[model samples]
Target: MKNITIIGGGLVGSLLAVLLARRGHKVDVYERRDDPRKAKPWEGRSINLVVSHRGWAALRLAGLEETVRKITVPVYARMTHDPEGRTNQLAYSIDHKANWSVSRGELNNRLLDEAERVPGVTLHFGHRCEDVDLDKATCTFSRKGAEPATSTGEVVLGCDGAFSAVRLKMQFGRFNYSQEYIEHDYKEISFPAGPDGTSLMDPNCLHIWPRRYYMLMGLANGNGSFTGTLFMPHKAVPEAPDAGFDVIRTEEQADRFLRTHFPDAYALIPNMTEQYMRHPQANLVVVRCSPWVHGATAALLGDAAHAIVPFYGEGMNAGFEDCHVLCKQLDKHGDNNWGAVLETYNAERVANGHAIADLSMRNFIEMRDLVADPRFLLRKKIEGHLQAKHPDRWMPLYSQVKFTDIPYVDALREGRRHDRIMEQVLAMPGIAEKWESEEVERKALELLDKA
Candidate 1:
């Protein structure tokens, strides 16, 4: 078995360590941050995570499915709250398959605990990787009040997040990389449970307040409280002066904004203005890099390889899927063939990474604006009808992404095709009323075949 060195013992790093160790590989994980299990509950860069099919598959393969499941609440649908506080429910899947909602901190802690339990795993917290020897699979780390330390393994994996130190080292060579920061920045808001500690909103649904230019989202916590995030442009959008975080900085402006745009959320969060004003706002970034593997001696995994916007909530899931796919390549190439394994892994994942990144950006508009549109809702209803009648012939793009193991590149291709066909189907006369009619089904099926 090969020895593995993993940098960044966050969610993906810890989970990857556990997976590699299970194969009898000696795995050492070096995390920059102090041990989260011993620290105050993690409040870092968290906009609560959504673990869908791919994520669960990886966790199940790593033998932590049930343990992780205990902490997740199943989200069956999205409850959209309009500007006037009217609500609409749209199930994620026609058959009501759930996407699991989990706290990033909690998931990381549990996975770290699970990794520690494995005999072949060793976790060294506070050893921040500063430099790497890519060809030799060595990483030099700095720790508190000590000389720099180094760990060398047969293979080094970078599970560090978007702004990865390991990835920085790789760039010293001939690596291609780019980082794009979106215009929107997000702030966290807490919605405490009811006075008796029961949830104030529907715990089973992901609550969304879509205001087109900006939005608010809430996901239930295990303790009946909810973690809410407000996403808005950093500067005032030229077309909408009051829409961005820049213009909504004052407590009075925030109060009026919330009361006008997200009245339902305002009602649920009594300290809405305080939370808005006091909490730090974090920017959203999409990081894309090429040739994740460095001459077969080292590789980048998870966010280090592809950091996407959180619209689809597939960032972690895609990273988890990366681990699973890498292991699958190992199994096929045999564990010791690092050259072949890393080559195949990079070839298979890079395009898919780009595809998911684009799809996520597309979903941002869908979540922030399209969800509130009557045509968008009507289109979903028509798509649902098609799927119910012709399950083998059609599945919504959302289901393909969240409920299936299909490659993301394949999903994106199919999703675009679906969009084209749906555009035509929705333009048909009386689509809103006759969505379930045999004529509409025939039109959709015909377009699908032609496309």
Candidate 2:
């Protein structure tokens, strides 16, 4: 058994600790913040996450599937509400597969609890990672009102999130990294349950109000309430007209903006304006870094490796899969062979990290604008029909990403090819009225074969 040290006790770190501990490693998880179970760590920043297929596969690998499932609310479809309050529903997958909505704080706490239960696992909360010696696999941590201390292990895993200190140390090396802040910023708006504790909206479907430039999304909580997030540009550009976070400064402006663009959501959330003003407007950043591992002594995982936007809903899932991938590498090359395992892990996941980052950005466009477009809706119909007819040959890109464990790099490439093929299929005369017709299907299949 190897002595492994993990920095950050968040979702990915805690999950990695569990996986490593199960493999008989003496795992030490050092968290910067206080124990979240004692206090709500994500109280103000309550971003709800959806665990898709890859996330579940990782959890199953750690034998925590049933435990995590208890806290997730199944989301099978998306319910889009237009400005006029007219609603449309689209199933996420044709086979009735569902993604799970989980509160980030709750999930993390549960995983932390599970991690502590492992015999050789120890969790050190309130111990912030300060520095690292990459060559020696040693970390220095500091606590409030306490002297700094250093710990050494066989290997150090940096799961410390986007602004990781371990990653900071690695940045001094020949590493390549970039962080781009998206124009959009987000704030949470809570939707209370009905008087009887019943869901105010369709609990099984994710609720969306997609208004070209800005959008509001809601996911159900197990307690019958919903967590709604409004995403808007941080600053308005001369070419773009909709109000950005800069323009929506006052309570009156916030009220007007919510009432105008997301009237349905405004009606559902009682204190929309108050919550909008009270909650912090958090920016969305995408971080890309190469050479995720350093000489087998230390490596990065989860958000530390590649922090993508939340549009694709695969951020946490991708991070969880990182742990699963590393575990698989260890199994393949034996636990003691850290050199071979870390090198292979870096090679295998770096490109995938980049691919999922691109896919998430692409999905942001689809979710924010194309979701409400007539042509985009039509394309979804055509794609769904094609998949239904030719299950063996076709799977929609969304399904490939969310419903299966297909490599994200392959999925992104296939999605682009489907985009090209759909362009031709949609151009066929009368495709709007005859998308289900065999001729359209045959033409799509022929195009796929040709491509």
Candidate 3:
């Protein structure tokens, strides 16, 4: 068995430790933060994590599927709120398949609990990774109070997040990397439950208020509460006058803006202004890098390899798939063949990392603008209808990414092809009304055949 060191101890790193430990490897997981179980970080505020097919596949491989399911609330559709307090529902799948929502901090603590139960797994909390000796598979970690600690293993897995210290060490070598901070920033607004602990909004659907240039979203917690987020540009552009945090600097401005654009949300959140000003607006970033490995001695996984925008909600799922794929590579080439396994994994995942980064940005535009457009909604109906009638021949891009095990690279390619097919299908006269008709189906099939 190999000695493995996993840095970060976040969602992806903790899961990787469990997967590796179960396979007889000596696994050590290091976290920069305090222990979530003891600290209870999910209590006051937490962004809900959506666990889709890819994440489940990894959890299932680790035998934690049923356990993780207990903490999640199933989200089968999106409930979009309009400017006039109107609402529209878009089902994620025609047959109503769901993506599970669990608090990010809760899931992390649960995974650490599971990781700790394993005989070969050891978790080191508050041990911030300081430096790494990539060639020797060694890492130095700085604890909060005590002296710096150093550990060496046969392999170091850089599961540290986007701003990873392990990745910083990798940067000293021949690496290609780029970090892009999007124009958008976001703040969390808590939606309290009713007196009897019942959800005021539909708990089974994700709630979105798409305002063209900016948006607000809410995901349910099982206790009848919701965590709402407001995403807007950090600074307003000439084109979007009322779409930036800069426009809502004061409490009065924030209150007026919230009530005007999202009257329904403003009503639901009683102290919207208080929470809006209480929480800090966090920036979003996307980081992409090449060769997520260093000669089989060290490698990166999860956000260290690809940090994507959260619009697609596949960030954690993609990272879990990394764990799933890496474990499979070990099974294919045996545990001792680190060279072959690392090379194959890096070759396969780097392209997928880049593809998902692009896909997430595309989804951002869809969520912020197109979801509120009549034509875009019509296109989505047609895509769903086509998938219902021709399951094998047509699968919507969202389905491939969220509902199936298709790689992100393959999903992005198929999604682009679907876009081309839909463009022609939607061009047909009366397509808005005939989207469910057989003629529209035939035309779509023909276009698919030609493409």
Give the best candidate by lDDT. 2
Q: Tens-digit lDDT track for model 2 on 381-426?
A: 9888888888999999999999888999999999999989999998
Task: Give the range where candidate 2 is weakest over 10 consecutive residues by summed lDDT.
Answer: 236-245
What is the Cα-based TM-score of model 2?
Answer: 0.99
Q: After superposition, how far is residue 32 of candidate 1 from its true place, in Å?
A: 0.4
TM value for model 3: 0.98
- Please give the CA lDDT of all the candidate structures: 0.91, 0.92, 0.91
How high is each candidate's TM-score? 0.98, 0.99, 0.98
Candidate achieving higher TM-score, 2 or 3? 2
Question: Which residue pairs collide, candidate 3?
Answer: none
What is every candidate's alpha-carbon RMSD to the true fold?
1.1, 1.0, 1.2
* Candidate 1 error regions (>4 Å): 42-46
Each candidate structure's count of clashing pairs: 0, 0, 0
Task: Report the C-alpha lDDT of model 3 over 1-451, residue by residue, as the tens digit.
Answer: 9999999899999999999999999999989988878874543357987999999999999999999999999999999999999999999999889999998988998999999999999999999998899999999989888999998899999999999887888888799999999999988888999889999999999899998788999999999999888889999878988768888888998888899999999999899988887788888999999889998798899998999999999999999999999999999999999998999999889999999999999999999999889999999888887887889888899999999988899999989998888888889988878889999988889989988
Evaluated at residue 273, the lDDT of candidate 1 is 91
Alpha carbon RMSD to native, model 3: 1.2
